[model samples]
Target chain A: MNILLRHRIILPVVSLAVLLAATFYMQPRAMSYFGLNLLFNLAVPIALATIAQMMIIMVNDIDLSLGTFVSLAACVTATFLNDAPILGLAILLALILSYALLGAMIHAFELPAIVVTLGMSFVWGGLALFILPLPGGVSPGWLRALMTVKPPFAPMAVVAPIIIAAVTHLLIVRSGIGTVLRGVGGNARSVQRAGWPVIWLKALAYGLAGLFGVLAGMALVGLTTSADANIALRYTLLSIAGVILGGGEFTGGKVSPAGAVIGALTLTLAASFLSFMRLSPDWQIGAQGAILILVLTARLIFSRKGAGT
Target chain B: MTNSMMLFSAAGLALIAGLAEADTSGKRIALSNNYAGNSWRQAMLETFESTGKQAVADGVVAAADAYTTSENQATEQAAQIQNMILQGYDAIILNAASPTALNGAVKEACDAGVTVVSFDGIVTEPCAWRIAVDFAAMGREEVDYLATRLPDGGNLLEIRGLAGVFVDDEISKGIHEGVAEHSQFDIVGSVHGDWAQDVAQKAVAGILPSLPDIVGVVTQGGDGYGTAQAFRAADRPTPLIVLGNRQDELKWWAEQRDANGYETLSLSIAPGVASLAFWVAQQVLDGEDVAKELTVPFLKITQDTLDEALATTPEGSVANVTYSLEDAQQVIASAR
Candidate 1:
């Protein structure tokens, strides 16, 4: 239990610290308030996305469609939320309900989450395409104002990650509902014996995941000031990688919202850092992958050392 | 003088000189496009549909059918082409998903006596006629305009298009080549805009604090307005922002021209060139000899022409000029 706890928090903190130090050393300006904002400006959406992925992982399920779902939400947010508020709100609510139904269906039918989501990605993407056939839409005035709000003390970019991580950590790690969701992942049989509906818990987790996905999509659209069906497509793999990089396991009810945010930040910073270093865009992706592998290896080593003790 | 304008005028003459060589009246034309995710593709489709209808009115072709696939898969596009062949289209104007992935289908269409012409994002099939603007020249022209605007050396911030794309690489190469000639200019910063307005705005916003005084900004299509917005939002003096052919950008440029006395050139691959492919197909069907490859000049819009483009351009649509048959003949002749 001690090893598990340490791995959950300590590994990600260490990795984040190391990355921060390296970035500051290479580009001192990144330490400034404005510089930090520029570096982390896009991290809020990514953090929300990682948390969404974390919720699904807590239920020991994966969502291959999370990225496209986020994109769909952005499409909805950009078009409906701006033009027809009532209709847009109704559609978004229906989307959340559909996610809950999807979870229930997955549990009842004994479907693999991967296959279900993989198929659903097309549905979500096609829906987004139907809504916004082209990559042009006006972001709602309020959302844009919210995204660009510059706090007096620090840029919202820097503050957003912390708030997102804290709130998600509290809800998913500290709350009683969170424990039930994780319990479902750990052992549905026991949870069922305890007179709890396993399917309900699973559905609840999926609903929460959908909520966060919507928030992520909206935040991204707010920042970018427009929406496209394929805009957030890169988030699918990135969110999964963030969860894993934060010491979350693929199996068991082992996931950390805080760690996932840190992992996302680490990854975002790595890209920005590389850009500041003036590396070719061709080399940036490879370099970011290398960083991921190195961090994972170090985490593995540290876990092994703790296990030996 | 813009070389393209000069070249275009010369081509216009050739087209007028060669107008009587072909008459295409009853050919069925089909437009097969790979994606419609961006304004560029949407504008291209609209242009093709409208121009094809015009061709029908002029007895240039019998029917013009357009098909667009949202999925950016080569197989999907190739399948669409095969179905078009099966549908008995006399000619297929294609904007391919890949450079070579559609070769097999294109070859089949050609073997079946179908005239195939690809434009914008074109194909590499030996049997198809390809129409494309010289992207390198566009890039070079962007820098050349910058050089003339800022004769003395100044820092240039290059907002590149999507990373790892062939067009992106080609344009970037051309920009570098153009910059190499002007000893006074230096590119101090670069970022990928992904050819989207909002993406470019966010990226430019992020990098602005880190960059020194930027004298000018160079970008591919779909991002110029966003770059200008970033500058305006940052309260920085708006530099010379080279524009692509989006109506939004052109409109914004006209506004800036009036308000801030801003002046800059606008250049883009007229999405209407898809219609050029249709016209080419018509010529081929009329038994006129056409080249396997055709290079079309990018439309260069100056202050004098900017208003005309904006006036005719529909709101929220890209500004564009279609090629007349006379102009089309000139384009075909330039290949030789």
Candidate 2:
């Protein structure tokens, strides 16, 4: 909120500007159709997940179960609510409450997020499997229609993710907990010395990560019009990619929300570029793996260069 | 490491022969693919390039070239088209990105005297003939099986692949049309599995507790395992008449479930897409007058015929046998 804080957000803002500009330039035609469903629902959940990772990284922790949480939340939602609109609401609330409790447990005990979240993800995956033996549930056609029908300028998928990210970022920066998160990132030892509830802040961080998982799940469930446990698994790596791509670090340091957004868009663009090249599906996989590596290397190089200066 | 792994490992061995063909023969072929994220893509590529190599070895074509990429980007695939132009490939097979982005590249390929073939996936653009499978028709084929039996009517649960992918939409579209005339069947649930076993399993599990009177489940790919697991877990007898890809276990499960009083409507089809690709490749290469679109053989192997096919075939081959280069050449000649 302060002028100084705004200045700090500048680098990520600029990075996002560059990414959006490139996005416009690369797909001049898609510039107007800017809000496709894949972008909104499918893409946004991952973006928010990335932001959630950013918050955790700012505090020098990592949440490995973010993807698991999303997948599990989605699986539960579709299975329980496939027939009714209330299923969606019920699943969403259940996911948030369960994750919040888990986050509290993790932070209250001062457990390592890498360990805590990873274990939690496995638990969720197991739970999903136990619940759904086969992938054969019909979505309440209403939610599918709502998610698919793009609102005027762009599809709900694209806009919804952006809105979620914006709201999440506001909470991260403007709220009291947001300050503690930053403060914890700066010097958790000092924050603890200053008598802040360091444990609760970390717990809330995981809760935020859970929120990202559910949102991404919702979008994915909407995007694919079905939910799968493995879908979220891929984003685990991508979420990390998005976070690091956004210039965020996990070991309790600075994280730029804007950089995370730009990182996601850039990755999207890279994938699109591969499509334009008309490579084989086999080649596409290799190329995406290659490009993901390239982007990560680029991010690392830039981060190192920035650190050196 | 993966490159060497690809070379040293058998995972890409069938495709590697395709790379060798580029050098042995003078002509080059480039494959512009839309998305490589799914198993359907992998199985397709394995069958495609292997067949491409077989053709080149038999002197059916001058040379062969290949490229692979992901579905996330369209421009990069378009760029690959240009790359094919620079490389001077004799032909290009497009699985396509968005069906429209490749139009410019396809025209360029044709202009350069390079034949273009679209397979499995239709480019939606006007190009050389499309060697595509009739997904809509196939949907009817599967649905018809269920319809003729369920004259008295029953509940049907349809499981689809990726919502946006061509496979899911076209197949489901066919199902919608096929069941239109049939009055007895009601679609209970449609879950998106993206063609993964774990997903299929999870989806079936969610609905089992609620739907006690569910009749038949229509699925794509080898999803029988997922379905069976869900049924086993729920302490429900496996439905005898489930529709699925020809996995080995489906045969045993069907017999066992039937004995246990569950009517399973299951089929393990292999010669489905692989045969289509083989036929398409032959038709395109030999300049055959085959229909722009053709439907390959889809086996409806039930308990009666599962053993014979399994004995001669590999554990999970789509077809009883894969065609050699000579067979492909014949298919091509027959089309002409």
Candidate 3:
């Protein structure tokens, strides 16, 4: 009970409640029809991107390429998915593998993730453009439907990611891998000297990030029903906002699934709130910018307290 | 006596050559079109450069200066106009970024005896002739076309271009006016799509699942491209009619419907920018007395016309759409 209270679960729960309360303010017509749909649209991609970002943060590294990772996943999947049901799974697998390899290359050089991912991001985005020079490319119908078509508020889009988040929580907290990853993120050289395969640990981190990036790519394909270069650019910054405010470090050493979930909800709510206020869409960009600044400020204050304490 | 005759011959020859040169020089012309920094604007520039070269070959004018920017910085455009006036160009053609903003510059050019004809985007101050595609008519056409298809009148969603823009506001006004006559066609509301496909798609994805009976959709920009993806995935005949841009993708959709022998009615108002480009150039050259506001009427192409045009198009390409400035002058003249 003490752990539960101290762990900041209340912050997330309360934020989710605030989001729900804001929902009451929407037009009844829009509330009934589009509110959950909008949430679902943001959920899958944001969650996957957040998780991918968290993996990098755990190790004190950052994959600024997450948005690009998503685009590459879509470019690969869309170019090859071929409307076959089996092709969908193949595309998903190929995307994760491709990013994993990209991660491995970066890992081999012991390079700062921001620098590596930045270059990789451009390469991946270029691949996306090359694959779909125009907007009318075909996305597999089954995945697109599962991702987009809503059945009330209980859309697969919203539910599937929540379930994945739950499964991830059980794996990380209940398993031995979670403890080692935490220790490694806090100090990699120490973990390495202590005989933990540090490269594999970071490799696992990159692979996990890539896996989630592909998931976001697939989810985005469903939501928009068309994949393009711009989708990646939109989420590039938001994923960082999710992780930083969730209080995750740059290298994946210590992070919480619950906090990440809350971070996603918080970002989504903030956007919905501004949009609901009928503020010009321009304000949406400004509001997001402000949120990032506030989150960074809080992180600084919290870090100072931790040091002083 | 022999030295005097030789000197006279040299002076006479010089005088005759000067007369011949003056007769052949035609007139000097300059263009200062406001730029919107869009592909459509780029297409206009390409046409302008090509047309100017062609006109020069035809001796339309001595030369045409092409000045472009992302926004028609009225100050910069005014400076260019001043330069043209100083250089003594016969006239200037313009596309103003803002009607109210360009007042001082436009007035300056007019005072300098520089003939000014505006096209694409126009100014209210009325320096000279305003050449444009009938934006209001395009809006009415979309609403009327959609209502005709869905007589029982279902929920309608309007996706407009840049908010508060002449195209956006006038089309919206025209749509409301058109729908006012019908009991069935009710417009839900309008949202700015910014003439971008991604924006329109995201809006549609959010709006579509909620409104189960969206009988009609109105759009400005490549929104129809995004809308088609959603409808195709749902595997339905977008039973809802579309008021969409005449882009390659939308043209393909129209062709698909025609191939299956279904009547696809899409009302696309091809930009009057092309005709306006030519007309403004000619007017500036010919020194024609033109009006301050010239509204060019758009051709209301239906399935019949589209099918006929498609058959004639180069394989896999939509046929080029051409609009005549005279046709616009006639329509706007009649409307007034």
lDDT of 2 by residue, B106-186 (tens): 555566566677765555545565655666777777678777666676777777887777678988898888778676778
Docking quality category of candidate 3 according to DockQ thresholds: incorrect
Q: What are the clash counts of all predictions, listed in order?
A: 0, 69, 17
Best by DockQ: 2
| Candidate 2, A151-244: lDDT as tens digits | 7766564566566557756776666777788788778888899898777776667667666667666655543444545446656766777777
Candidate 1 ranges with C-alpha deviation above 4 Å: B1-336
Q: Model 3 TM-score?
A: 0.48
Please list the C-alpha lDDT of all candidates, in the order they appear.
0.81, 0.60, 0.61
Range of the 10 consecutive residues with the lowest summed lDDT in candidate 2 chain B: B266-275
TM-score of each: 0.52, 0.53, 0.48
What are the per-residue Cα lDDT tens digits for candidate 3 across B22-51?
A: 443476656676564555555555556665
Model 1 DockQ reads 0.01
State which candidate, 1 or 2, has the greater TM-score. Answer: 2
Residues A1-309, candidate 3: write the lDDT tens digits.
335323435445555565567645553322433334444445567777888888777777777778877876765555567455577677677666766666566667877778988888888788777777643344667766676565655755456667866876775555688767766678777888889887777777777888888888776655544455544564677787776655555645667766676677677656655544545433556776786576667556655765577
| Candidate 1 chain B: worst-modelled 10 consecutive residues by lDDT | B16-25
lDDT of 3 at B335: 38
